[model samples]
Target: MLAQIAEKASDPAGRKIHPREVERVFGALLASSEFWRVVALSRLPVETVAEIIKALIDVGLAVQENGALRLTPGGNARARARGIVPLIERTCPGCTGRGIDLRPYAELLDQFKELVQNRPNAILEYDQGYVTPETTVARLALLAAKGDLQDKELIILGDDDLVSIAAALSGLPRRVVVLEIDPRLTDFIQTLAGTHHLAIEVYRQDLRRRLPAELCRQFDTFLTDPPETIPALELFLTRGLAALKGPCCAGYFGLTYAESSLAEWLTIQQILAGKLKVVVTDIIHNFNEYVNWDYLLESVRKDLSFVQVSPRANWYFSSMYRIETLADYDQENRDRENLALYPGENLS
Candidate 1:
């Protein structure tokens, strides 16, 4: 019998046997009376033996039919082909024993650790939860389309996170320069560009400080997702505006509470009103948590007055600028309000 088994194992066809065949062989071996007698004599628990049989079935080596476990034809062939007994085991219980899903933020962080180092630490410091790349990309695309970013020079005020990376990937701007405060982050960004072969200029300068001379009046588009604080807001919007060539497009977070944050967004609008028209106003919500329409509309009203002004500084506020709330993404309503605020094909 041993010689016959050796001959069968030596066959090239057996070596190429399918996995299913091996599973059946295990099932048949376990179901044999001789094997059961040995298992009982060895004092092995019935539950343990049953568990092993179940594992064989789970791995597709054995099948149960008419209350009898048996080796499938393919399982027998696979065992002979492999010239070894296959050990089937139960699937791992932790994490469902399945691999991680690569589509979410957690998986991306794992895969691109070098790009997003110390992710948990950074997130905890920011007190902001993670967002999926898909959601981030979709929102950015919407913003770009609304702002008419194509054929425009964009000035990004921060580069520590995925937003800067997304902007580089979008290729929506004619020229893109990222201004960041941390030198370490700046170095990381440079290394990121080199590793990914992306063309992006990174500047290691504080927003509170005067912008580099080369950046003055050089940007047509502006994107700001600044830190949610009074000092940071003032520095980024006020100082950063100096770099914009105008007409400019920008977005700011409108907090429901804290008059200071609301005031800061308005302050940015006021500054931009002097040069660029507030062409589009979008409110990106923090998930479905809350809406700050009151704060948003207040800022819009103030900014519109400036946009409606005439070329002359004195005549600008005389005529009321028709400030219309264009679009709002409210997670609570599960609906987006898209209103045409201004007339003309250009605004469309």
Candidate 2:
């Protein structure tokens, strides 16, 4: 029954959550063990574990004492009724998560790597970064595998990885629009589009200001790689959410656990679930690989010993999250146009 409750349960953000999102929360808990539950919820944009705990309690399947959960007599019965495996099941050998397998898109991934040398490198000031070329194509492969490609209009909030050009090269998506703060990135994208004759449009926008009026509710999907901090994630996610057209729309972005801990992930979940009314459909782990960011030390911070050199091995990793709009997009908040995400940046 879509997990419809008599009294609406709200997230920590104090905003009402969709029943559909609540249902997914329960499904995740049933599908994985406690350890995996912690891992799975980190990828989703909702305070999902709390909801699952509440559901178990409400149904008389579980109880809590001393901040720990205890399954009741009905807990086993409930698990049986739900057909939840008593223990963890073998993860799908392909996508590895509940999402579909994307290994078949090797051709696109290979094409993406071929274009890597020409792609832009990391720009430190703007926090601009690039993931490995293979991971870039992996993101697109998942998108296409999920049926998000093949003539959909997609927007990129920030494309430092330059996935937009790779997407355009696929000849699958209908439109590839971008909003980037770096003039260099925009110019490069434009140059690539001109050279390749791909229909990619690049717009120079400093997200410190409000998004363009025409961008609101204009695209089928959005993809972004925001700064790892919570505030930055909120701003990037908000802009992308506002740009999406309807409930059926989707967005893809990445978050690194190395930079953001579990608590930070929960805050992002609160924004997506409680505020934006979205549900995460897929979470592909370790999807993006970043080159070393420590090169700046060699150029500028010569004062310190160069003992810790820039890592040759690809170390930074980000999980790809595919979240879909569950209810209506937040129009009222969009109209206000005041951003609270980053104090360091100038606000509109």
Candidate 3:
């Protein structure tokens, strides 16, 4: 009977208790007939036991109906979810007992706290105020539904960056190959892959140099978020284009006023003119207000010509852009009709 009790004590969904918490609670349960007796044996006040019961209900373990504690349907399934009970005993170093911990990035943590303190509803990070991580994933789903990534070999350049991380986690591709300049970053990703049992390949290579011949024309889609510099952007665009099997989609942070920004966009247009077509152009708005509006507006004015040719262009003055293409073209009017319908919005 003790052995059966022991086995039941460790059952994940059954009791839904951590090993240590289980030992304590089970001891109490064995000592008393009434629920309050279990609380006394555990040395917790009656109020605390009530709270624990509430938590158990929230996790769908125990349900209270007609003043009786009963196991939920999920509670029965939890007993079958092997190893979960053991996992409860293991605490996350980053969070300790708390659900979230921001001490590692103390500076950013403080900034985030201050930003959200007054305007709790404000959206921050990659997407503008209106866009969310779920929305971004939904958009990727739309792309998938439209066959934008059908049987495509995808090469994700720059894994150490934020965009690369987002792309890695998005899981919206047939296959993904990541190229990162930093060995440490590659190692980190490798560790993460092992931890999550994910099948992702990470290669250590500087994207500034010419891509390996084996990689040339090996991928149908090239996704990059290179450093925000004329030289770096040019290297990624030119070299990335050279490595593509066909037209691809790329995203970048654009500034409207910077001469370097205009030069980089124009250089990309010139380099990809014969081989790639610009299919989609979108600007992402920054919810955290980290975007440079003045620079974005000025850059847009300087490169209005390229903007005119893009099929779809969105003004997220301080956000990012998703540019797609077909085979190269000098002046394809396929997207021109759509472009005329929605003239660029003024960022001023």
Candidate 4:
């Protein structure tokens, strides 16, 4: 059955993907012939989905036809026998699944696109990738809608996406600060802030070192797109928590099922609640779409030889999380001397 194939479908690390994920991949193929659509529908990491597809092909259940997946006649019969069918598209088309419209923020999006036209390309060393211009503005719109942006002091832990600039452009936040390790990004943000006369500060600081004392307990809100590893998430979030001005403050970060598993997510949620003492208010799936990076073939794809079909579209994605501190506990917990507690902790 599908369970057997799921067991056989292992990642390069030799870990077996959950059987339910295998079924989800099968159901995704039944819904769409496009490969990237299958990835989106599966809601699994790209590498995991690719492994499932390879397993399906080995079992004669699926095949690649022109960069897309097709269910074999046997596979179709088996899926029908199991009562698995295509999922209905219930998400709002107008909002593009973000549950929020972009029409109201069209002007900001236009301005953002113009400003970032010459932004630095994603460097492999930084594990750098950015969301679309529209996504950046949409994130701002979400913050504004939630009453987190008006006259708020915001700190962005990393600026590969240049969210600091977008926040400045909105002219809503009281002040914006960026702590970026990349001199190129820090320099670019400083130049833009001066030219635009925006109330923004840019600093070049590696997050691995202790956060500057002056920056701690200074912001109303913080945002980061940390690497998906547990240690990286802990570090970024801990630093973010350290930057907040005590209770009722909020933080936003991104996590993906692509590189992380549900079990891993459960652990992360536990850390947010038990360690960081933040209550997760909202988790919007597919809320953040990353532009495909140029280093994939050299980096992510090197170990994913089973991923035969090259991506034709930008399919990488992560869910946006809004977490709020209920008490001063987070501030106390994150006030640590060493945020990097593990070996080789890299978020890029």
Tens digits of per-residue lDDT, candidate 2, 230-286, equal 767877888888788888889998986645655677888888888877898877677
Between the candidate structures 2 and 4, which one is better when assessed by TM-score? 4
At residue 10, give the lDDT of candidate 4: 82
As a TM-score, model 3 comes out at 0.40
- Candidate that scores best on lDDT: 4
Of 2 and 4, the candidate ahead on lDDT is 4
Taking all chains together, each candidate's TM-score versus the true structure is: 0.42, 0.65, 0.40, 0.91
Candidate 4 regions exceeding 4 Å error are: 11-16, 65-67, 302-306, 332-348
- Candidate 3 clash total? 13
> Candidates 3 and 4: which is better by TM-score?
4
Candidate 3 least-lDDT 10 residues: 333-342
Name the regions of candidate 2 deviating beyond 4 angstroms: 1-104, 294-309, 332-348
Q: Residue 127 in candidate 1 has what lDDT?
A: 21
Q: Which stretches of candidate 1 lie over 4 Å from their true place?
A: 1-120, 123-132, 248-280, 287-348
Q: What is the lDDT of residue 83 in candidate 2?
A: 55
Candidate 4 TM-score, C-alpha based: 0.91
For model 1, residues 1-348, the per-residue Cα lDDT tens digits are 223322333222223323343343344364342333222222222223334444455556556654345556765675576565534334344322222222333443344444555432232222232234443344345445556466667677764444566656656667778887566567777777778766778888755456777887677555554444544444555444555654333443223221222244566456444333333244432211111121222222232222121121110000001111212211111111231211121222
Stretches > 4 Å off in candidate 3: 1-146, 162-171, 247-318, 329-348
What does candidate 3's lDDT look like per residue over 145-230, in tens digits?
Answer: 44545455667666433222333454545566777755556776676666655456788876545576777666666655454444
Colliding pairs, model 4: 45-258, 127-348
